[model samples]
Target chain A: MTMKYKDNPQAVADLVRPAEVHRDLYIDDEVFALEMKHLFASTWVYVGHESQVPNAGDYFATDVAAQPILLARHTDGEVYVLHNRCPHKGTKIVIDRTGNTGKFFRCPYHAWSFRTNGKLLAIPLKKGYKDTGFEQSEAGQSGLPPVGAVKNYRGFIFVRMNQEGISFEEFFGGSLSSLDNMVDRSPVGKLEVAGPPLRYMHNCNWKMLVDNQTDTCHPMVAHESSAGTAVEIWESIEKDENTKTPMAMEVIAPFMSPYEFFEDMGIRTWPNGHGHTGVHHSIHSDYSAIPGYLEMMVEAYGEERAKAILGENRHNTVYFPNIMIKGPIQQLRVFIPLAANKTLVESYIFRLVDAPDMLLERTAMYNRLINAPTSIVGHDDLEMYERAQEGLHSQELEWVNVQRLYDADEDLDEEAVENGTTERQMRNQFHAWKKFVVASMEAEARDLTDA
Target chain B: MTLPTRDDLIDFVYHEARVIDEGRFDEWLELWGSDSYYWMPLDYQQDNPKNMTSLMYEDAFLRKLRVERLNGLRTFSQKPKSRCSHVLNRPSIEAFDPKAGQFITRTAVHYVETRLDDQFLLAATVHHHFEMVEDELKIKLKRVDLLNCDAAFGNIQLFI
Candidate 1:
């Protein structure tokens, strides 16, 4: 199958601009397919944390732009990201999302075997192929195609399907501090996955989830009903001397914050569509200190540095297309694109190693209350995303406006630090989106012409 | 042992369901002891609430918050209001503690909830650990093992 649009980079590039993006970017089938090939397949997508697959033979399976991939810890203590397909007949070796494949991966279809690092070990009935010319091919030698590049930064693993882009550190730019702050929270500078993730699917484009990460404008409007209920209930309790404010109300009441609060909170946009808001402090600041944890931190890093580390409270850090990390709350949401209109979100909670149990408990509580599939606050966000996808199907709405703060800070450098309520982050993402798509399209066109 | 008769236990379970089905949240609150726990584990055989995940875990304070939100007119998901019916199997007493006036009863329940023409059926094994204080049986712990606890769920605005 041939697509003429692949040759015309300008057609894809014109879909995105500094101030607005065409609805086709989210709704069109061709655009989604291009994004999967160019944007997702060509960039450094987060696979899993090294802590998730701690021991030898432990494997975590996931998709990189619809390409089934697995991250397995080999016996040599190195984690390798490999294609999940058995090279012999293209059968998926790892069916489960995550498990220990033991010493090596044994394909259920045939008796083909491979090492934990995806090196082909043996094929069934070697005598039959002995006389044949099938001595050693790429399929017989290498069981599966290992990911192009696998890098583990402070236990966070990122894999690139194609080795066309820059290094992960170069890709992360200034946004690396967000991850630094997350791991540096612990005195030992290590973190662990709390447990199995809370997995759910939404009927919306994957970009919608990414856009919502730095969007400070939606909470007040989208969650008006639920937040208002919490406020009303809280006031009634305050009026009565018998009752007290419920701790759970803290989760919902923050959604009722006036626009001015978010406006002043500030947003920071880095290179490569990486951006975050609520960088100064958040509602987590209001909670009482985790008992004795501060002393442990101060002892390790001294008072000034410990204070700085603990005070860096970021709401959500968008790592381009697939990952968002909430440093203070100790949670990460990974978006997996299933199609143009469907995305599967897997949310993982992290625990700071050697930290007080109270801290982990608080984070776990926040995950349940805020990110759980049955969460009231999360339901409001899901409703808006689904509605946006459904509403954009109309031909009347061609352009989705991302014009806030466009005139205020047209300068690229100055735009990095803007008001939190500004849609600068969204615009910045589309800027990277255009760059990635156009580059990939041009590369494919070059290959075709050369052929 | 001062255990409630099988007939008494059946009546108690039915009346509890009636309170929830009829949207009598205030009356439902009265059915629990002051130091009671309402929890639904996120994973099968999930024992520790503090260490692991739970679909729902509420002490009296959080439970009160949920009730207040459901009754508040501004609760949008509950705007059209949720109607539910609970089909409970015959109660089986698991244990009886004479000294502490406590009894553990187990039952299988099929809970159907409808709101704004959208309906969901949740099947679960319920364990009600109650104590007989004087003649009143108050729930000390209501643990629900949902058949699909780990599955993706929409807004669960009201009590399960």
Candidate 2:
């Protein structure tokens, strides 16, 4: 039996427009549910990196679409993304966020056990339900249900919960290169998760964070206190003759780059609400080189290939519904939607295998300074998000605007490219948000009609 | 010349909290010795800050930069200005080394930071590593570990 996907998709469709979107899209309960079902659960979301669960039996448990899910490396050495559930009873099998399950996952409740690949091993009493539905059902023996598909492109494992929407290849398409670029930067051509991520709670809808990725306009204004302050202090230090300004200042100054700088940087949006910034140059492009980072790259890939790998720096890549990656910086931030009004942003940096220790340190510095819960820059953005969440509740404003460079981007293809200041990315995102969310409902309706 | 006793060491812990709570940031700066660090770990039993990500890992440079940003007039987020209050369980003097001039104190505290109807209380265990810099007690390291360190937290605008 299938769920009667709650009717009236036009309500979802009406919320998004070419240049503006309804305030309800950011604050409404109904829209959030539609998103959780049609967009998040249906599509391929980046669950975790393969390096996180490298050895056999290592598992990383997390919530996907508000359901308990874990990525485990089976004894067979193939990684499987499975529902972190016990089929016998509904209790969660693994409690630890991440650990090795050893030989198999043992249930704390019923003494039932499962293989790492989600195959039911044995129950306590084998003859208890000999004649029941248990003998006829595949589900009884199939321990934990895996997600619809798992695509591990260069160690970035993406899982789609159900095969209701677009195929993984069609869903990702050209956007896969962003993940490729991140892995290619590694001297050994591999990346590993540094450690547990820094999770910051936002009291706002998740889309606000998604929209913020290509929102090149806000950093100069919102981070005036943070990155702007760095500039002032560095200038003060510069006035003294003997002092050379610190590397810390250089890390933050580009965020406060002028409008023209961002305009020159540019943005490119793909078909399925995926896109990237730093077309000409990213905020990361100006940083002082780490001592041995480029040397390691050159040794690995020679001059031209290493130059291309090091030279091309993308600021942020939005993989639709949830995650964003900064390829050059070797960092990823996932916006896990907790509720209509709450989101938990888990930010993690990757260690390029065999790269300079300073590169990881530099990435850590950026993570703490920009993305951490205590981040001086992130505080300003969080403040705005909270205010927007609060203000959207008012009866006054019905719609939110994303009209910057709207007209300019009209004459573009399936892959739309525009200036950094353009709201084309937001337009591209909301357009997909409507298509994914509405198409699911329409498909359900068509099913009912065909039946 | 008076030798610093346990009472004086306890006073230093309470004084540090008051300085931060009262928002006397410049005065707070005077309380730190050179090469001091303020660390809030991301996970329980987090061993080192250099290798792993932290809730915050700040040196003098970052600390000053944070203060400057908080004090900046153009920082729209701090327009209302965040304020904090420390409800401390009396400090326990863990160790006293007078010869090498080092003192260690631990305190369990409920730190509340609030601004414009948003008030969040943080349950924390604070470990302060102190060293006497020219006879004046100064903090060498302040490590704050939250009970909910593994849990998601809202943006912390003020220093703990």
Candidate 3:
């Protein structure tokens, strides 16, 4: 069924208030379709991390904005994001989650093959379609259709449906510096996706996950069980100093702190719906333990530059429509919108290239503690999102509130500061959403662009 | 060195499964020695437990914390209780070292878990490294290599 929008664009604009959004945005299927076309399709959506397909013939398959895409590293050392469908019969190739294709991808159905880069190689019968007007040499029809536009920012890849507009740096705005801060922390200045990600489908809107990334307000309320459990573990270990490792300290320390601590650390909201929150105290408690890392940074960039690299501790940075960069843990979670109610979250844990084993282990422990299936912290979040989904089904309420610190003034500089408890981040997200959606609608009306 | 007797190892495994299925966590913890390690490696190349991360790398302290939380009345995930069943088959004693008094038993494990209305099954190769201590069988290492170890997952609170 088609959704009927208000005839006036200004009336449609009024649906999103600074402190609240209409509940229809979450439950209406028509609005979801429009969001996929305008918000997801037009904006640069995170595809996958470069470390995922490091070697030739390595391919990672996933869906973005409800479109099936396969990110593959070709034999030529270039990563390509191609449509998963085979051109001949339109069957999906490479059914497995991840595997090395050796040299090329051969469709199991017809045995039609293509290079690891997705260039068509051979067909089953050469003479079958000789007179059928099928042109095999034309790369347009036979080869796998590549994503509209692909760009990589510091090994993190993003794809956009529209070829023109702002560059990825411009699209990311202030969030781009967060990526730089992440990579710079590693002495070698590079990071790779360590292992396969844990894939799960959540029965909630994708926005819930995005919001929760920088939503410091919910940690104390939602994750009380996890925080309590962490404290209990810390107390048990305190009796025996021998068992209290640095890695365990990293995992337990964050959870044991009071909610007021995180609020006092402050938050910074950037344009384009990107923001970060955390106490910028220290990246690592024991930076001196990794002498080799410290030496490399000091040698290449000097001690002052090294200090700046280690000083940034912005916990989680949200990249607008889909991705959340967790700098402390070196983890990234990308949300792929499946439906209004269901979202597929693909998480990747990264290892800092050439860093100390202990450092990597610490980062991995953080990932396991927070993102793992058995995480005490995540259970509360999953429950909350599920409840939010069910609560939105009510016919009585037409709007959802984001009223915390709603009237507070916001900083518009590159490093913008806002009250950590404020709904400023949510407002920023909606402002960006309106800009993209309305711009697309206006562009469509003017040029009659076909998508 | 030769593999352990298939029947004897299968009996041991089935008993262990029963303890977990019946929610006898304290009894389940008794199967391990003081130095026992319960490790679930995150990736294929994870070589050293001290350096690389594992899904569940617990010593006695961490194990105690897990048990305490599981037995805690406040564990919200466990409020309704998660029901689980283990179906063991295709037991293969991959390797054994009698001189070292250790044996490696590999078996295919199909575990299904249900909470409220959610149900999912996991198929994996479970490797149990057992050692003879004081003439009694004790688990040195319990490693589960899941079929989709790298896939995104929801909360995995209990041991598999």
Candidate 4:
């Protein structure tokens, strides 16, 4: 049986055709609201990492689907996710972004308290509600409403508001390799976020930022000026004396790779909207020159396993809807959607535990030179996102094209591989988006009828 | 046991800021010691740079690379060049150890920068630690603690 939407399903269907998406899908307030409801509310969203709150009473405040949510570790060492609103009078629990809430959470508004797991602890005036219909059961005061499902896989926590959907394992699928490869770099399979994340706001739709992650066509053009500067610097130094390309130039020059080199690197996608392309070792393959790191890896996990771990060089893996993992460089960039035209990007660098100090130093260098606000390379990407957003506002342009090789066989799961320059990743994302929206609207319509 | 006076330290800081503001990259480069470090830490009370990250942590080599880009004609972001005006509060000498030959000073700085019709303000408490090589004080470590260092920012291409 085919489910039907109460509202204009034709409009939603037409929003994402086979080869193009309507411009309004990005800037329309109605579409944004529907996405927040159907796509965000129903899917699994990434919360804070478990290492962020390792000790009991440690809490990290973040949002899932624009809804303020709290992630905390209790005395039992189990992590839990809860809505940020207080049960009484509906005030926020933790005012600051993150900190260790000693013992339990004490609300600033009415002095109501809750445990680290959001269990109602004590209220200041207990006798006032003796017979006022405020029952004294475990859920009487209604401490806080927790998300329907919370799963922590290898210390990376993901939460889903709706209970029914694909399991976390199934939703992540082959994309889990991205996370596994990152964690497995550590001999003990653990990695810690090195420092505080570098946060910045981009004036564009969130999807545009995500699309650019695997959109190989734009880098050569968008980064032309900065890449030219790097090349000029390298050439000037070489002209003066005998020297190799500067490490900084090596980092920026790859963004200028010819279309042929980029396309030769395969673009592959999995079930759901996950996709990744480009080589793993990238510019940092030279990092193999560092001493004792390979020996240490060989000692920990034998030569075969170590070689496999070091040899798997995949770049820019998108876990769909929000996160992008550059596993080779040990950096995770998360996109948080603020509005139809605004997004927040947080860059988190990781440290491979028990690894050499040079690895962490290189990771830090990459973040400063690439992800920082002062980044010469990053400004190019930012300019492109903003310009694309502004250009979409023109009344003449109705559709944003994703038709590059749209008819290719890359859409099939068994043969889901294409040249890096193809738009199959973007098209796959829309297919997933359409599926999510259609299911969401039908469920909403059924609820309206039931109500 | 002689030490540099407060006026001398203030003048040094003022001159440093002036050169950076004027885009006199060569003159600015001369103000640092051969083994100097310029750092802007990521965390408020960061412990060690080896384990943690920093926003701007540059050695002499990286610093020279940055200056090369800033001074280059091909730096697209710097083509129009950001102009800055720094308002520094009074400097106070914190410590003067004769044996160590290091003088420490601290000051508050409010910097206003403009580029292509966009302007932004950055405030930081600046710390300078140095020792006299002969008669001139060369900076060994210059640490800047931005008031909103952890917050979001636009491109920080120019010196602050």
Candidate 5:
């Protein structure tokens, strides 16, 4: 019997097992192509922050699954996600990284113009196409193609490819609460991308980064140099008679210890592959002791609510595939996949909606330590990710194990943990991966059959 | 406080470049005031230092920390050390404040560096905010506005 394209239900099922993942998933080009079509093309990918384009005619350029996309703010106060390709001759509308198009985006090639909202405004030499089937009223060929769907959660924006499946709220599930946890801390309940994001490219696979964000086992090892520096600074400050201790130093000291400190603090893996690791239980003593954070929180929300916001201590919260948010520092890192072995990570530092200047300064300091190229912590992880990419080229291993904490009892029905350093997070990601992949393949098969 | 000659200001630029090129970091540190500021604004429109974020913004304390780390034995990226040569030209004295005993000089600097056979050429606008301290001139601020601040940059091991 001939197997239909969608008939490979068994092959799709094999993608997620309780124990392991196929090695070819990472190394095979064919599998990567399938994933782009199935997973990335179906799920909602984070495009950019709404604060990036705050004014009318403001637009930011980004790429999703190799397709150039533009997120623009219309004059009417609506945000739109549209293809960057110009319909006339298919040239890109905006060539610059980011800028205001004034009233419209004018294509330099043929002088084709488009409204800030991507409506076709004018085409140079209209008489040249008099007999052509081009109609001014036809929305199809005149303007830029709109994305399948655009949704905003708070100030963050996301675009999906399929426009089907679960609603944004349903798809985010409990992870949506993570954004709330971030915004609620702000007195104004709003945050803006404070400055131009720092963009850097790494010579490693994109997945390696997503995995490392919540690994929970690498911080002490990866950041030892930074931790040591922090410790030295802290000690010197303490020894000085006239020096006052800065809260930034206190925030950096706990990270200098052995990995066991983080492992002991444990991890909480939520449903939908979202997870948090490292000191999620206790608030950073340095920050909790600060009167500025306390006063601001109390003023924004009542004392009871202030306590609730201040008490949450999530270190790194992975929003799956693309975004990893660090709540304590108010920094967000967005991962954009360039190729099978290349990734671009953009780091944005946010000033809390009504927080103190010192608070923002501390947050910026954290970003400098962790994400900047001068960072001792950043270099270590970059080296490891590069090594992982090179090592995966070996033809020896056929599967990578995800067996850590496989036997641990679960506090949440969706997660299973055997120990603090379990591989359950990896497994949860694979589960979500398999679902998106299979669903896309099944849709393609149905399209083929209908033809 | 009187304004210094344009020739003297140009000579000061060359002397500053020599201090960095020779890796006289200690002496380089002495060129700046105890409460000196270093800033690299992200955009041209940035006006106030407190409101906008910079690519590199460091007070005296953070600057000392950076220098300490660069000279520290455990700085892995600096294991082999970085060598740089700076070429300065077009020294235009933008403004001078006689009342405050300060001056603002703008110059174009072309900086080239090599570390382990990797080379980088950066063209930037260097702004010197200077003040007189006792008998010597000190830098209150040195802001470098690079043409490609947003591009993919390699490890910035040394001060630019």
Candidate 6:
């Protein structure tokens, strides 16, 4: 409450210790501001996917670290994540969420036209600026600058604005397999956007959504009201032992799985705050095989390779700052931090091209049943998130427990593996949170002390 | 039975909404046909709800499951039970084929769903297709075209 960590990065970093985290990490405005400014800028935040910008001149406008930016395909057949502001006026260039800019992006305010890659092509009224020495200035030539780093890995694009932190490969590390696993499920190892996303707003910190991904322990408890009821209803109906459960029931009932199911499933954490659950099993494991899906994979990758790709059935993969992907189900949700007290979750389902269309239908079903705003299962989680946001305002409490299974973690070279029930995934997340946010403050502190 | 009047069709639509507003799960369930869907499309121009993503495209089983979940004792989100009031414009009779035994109505509705101290209003065009099932008008398809279908929203706790 005293706000000691407002300027003290070390103190802020210390809030995230080995086992527990200070409650301010979720409730503090200064912390959230610092996270937005330093952490998201330096880290790899997912932009729109390459498939979203398939043709040259196509663009998808979004934000990174709260700065407006666009993932655009250039005329040269390359993808760049360029700042979405104009050099002349500083107004955001793209007004629409997604569209083809054709050969150039003409600003709505001024006639300043730019190439799809954000390079200034022409500016009207050049004569007005010539006498003022503005035409030859660096500001005039400077175009919509691309972010520090951009990688279109197998059509899944990611961008880092500052480039101060780890290399993209080093950041994602072994977690890259999750993306690889997702795309490889397609016969041609490609996927496309199914439709527009279902954006859900949550009145809570972005970290709560990120934390919930691998906070595997909450599902059986929080979702009991929703998915648990699905289980109860399914049980009440009598059927043959061999009869497969309805697809609708199959998707919802898994949330009521016993704690031991998740524990045995286990979780793993990578460096730079990335992790996933259901390494060997998840609620997605027993999904009845989609008709003709296996043969499609087999035709593309052959027996062993096809089996390997389909075999990697991970439930949730957290890509550090604000992205969670489900490889097996071909679903992705990104958390956009609007403010310390508000976050927006945009849920997207992908189409595994050439695979059985039913695969995508099931994914759509899963998204609607599990994540939609109208979802029974989703409402329970939303209630928890909102309540947690409200509850954290209490002055009495100062810490949130993250100690479960911490002692039993199997420390590896680049990651820590633990049971899915472990809070170790959260600990790993805060571990990276401290590194990204505190590095800037630490650097500033060093500069000050030297002066 | 005498051929039902157009007013009967209008009354049936009003009754269907009342059951949802009252949290009458059984009554709501009974209003639906055996093969039916409650569709809320994600986009205005969205033509199909089969494979593509939408806000929600729930079939009969999913509709019942949603009701059961809301009624679950452990549904903490409903501890402060959500309530709604539907103010509908007089439904226009889109089609009335008595011999074919099919009827359709289109109404614009302002739906306000509230829980605790927070509330939000949603404007939508409510479209319903009704067919007589065992001498009772049951909903064959209930489609809600929300004014902000594509816009971001919080958890829609109840049907629109």
> Per candidate, chain B TM-score?
0.91, 0.95, 0.89, 0.93, 0.90, 0.94
> Per-residue lDDT of A306-421 in model 4, one digit per residue for the tens?
98988877778888778888777788888888888888888888888898878777777778777777676677677677778889999987999998877844453432777877
Clashes of 5: 3
Clashes of each: 0, 0, 7, 1, 3, 0
The C-alpha TM-scores of every prediction are 0.93, 0.95, 0.87, 0.91, 0.86, 0.96
Per residue, candidate 3 scores C-alpha lDDT tens digits across A1-451 of: 4346422345446668777888766766766777787788788888888887889999988787787789999978989988898887778887876778989999898888999878889987769878766784443255777877899888988898676765677788767888888888677789887766656667888888887876777765665566566566666654564553545555655655565666676778887788877645422333235547767777766899987776677777888988888775577888877888887776677888777666676666666666666666666677788778889898888898877776645543244776565667777787787778767767766675454
The first chain of model 4 has a TM-score of 0.94
Q: What is the DockQ of each candidate?
A: 0.46, 0.78, 0.41, 0.43, 0.31, 0.80
* iRMSD, all candidates: 2.3, 1.1, 2.7, 2.5, 2.8, 1.0
Please report, in order, the local distance difference test score of every candidate based on alpha carbons.
0.81, 0.86, 0.74, 0.78, 0.72, 0.86
Alpha-carbon runs more than 4 Å astray in model 1: A1-7, A135-138, A238-247, A408-415, B1-3, B71-85, B112-121, B154-157
The list of candidate 4 runs beyond 4 A from truth reads A1-7, A136-141, A225-227, A238-250, A279-281, A408-415, B1-8, B64-81, B95-101, B131-138
Error of 5 at A374 (Å): 4.1
Better of 1 and 3 by DockQ: 1
Candidate 6 regions exceeding 4 Å error are A1-7, A135-138, A240-244, A408-413, A444-451, B1-4, B99-101
Clashing pairs in 1: none
Q: Top model by lDDT, which number?
A: 2
Question: How would the docking of model 5 be graded?
Answer: acceptable
Model 1: interface root-mean-square deviation in Å: 2.3
Whole-model lDDT, model 6 = 0.86
lDDT of 1 by residue, B51-159 (tens): 6567777787667766766766555555567788889998788877666666888989999988665788999999888877667778889899989876766656566
Cα lDDT tens digits, model 6, A1-451, are 6777656887887888788888888888888878887799888889988889899999999878988998889999999899988888788889789999899989888879988888888888777786787767765877888898888889888988885666888878888999999999999998998999888999999999999999888888998887877777778878897877888877878888898999989898888889999988888988889888898889888999999988888989999989999999899999999889899899999998888888888888889888888887778889999999999889998888888877744342367667788877888898888888898778767878999
Which prediction has the highest DockQ against the true structure? 6
> For candidate 2, lDDT tens digit of each residue in B105-130?
99999999998888989999999998
lDDT over C-alpha atoms for residue A206 of model 5 = 73
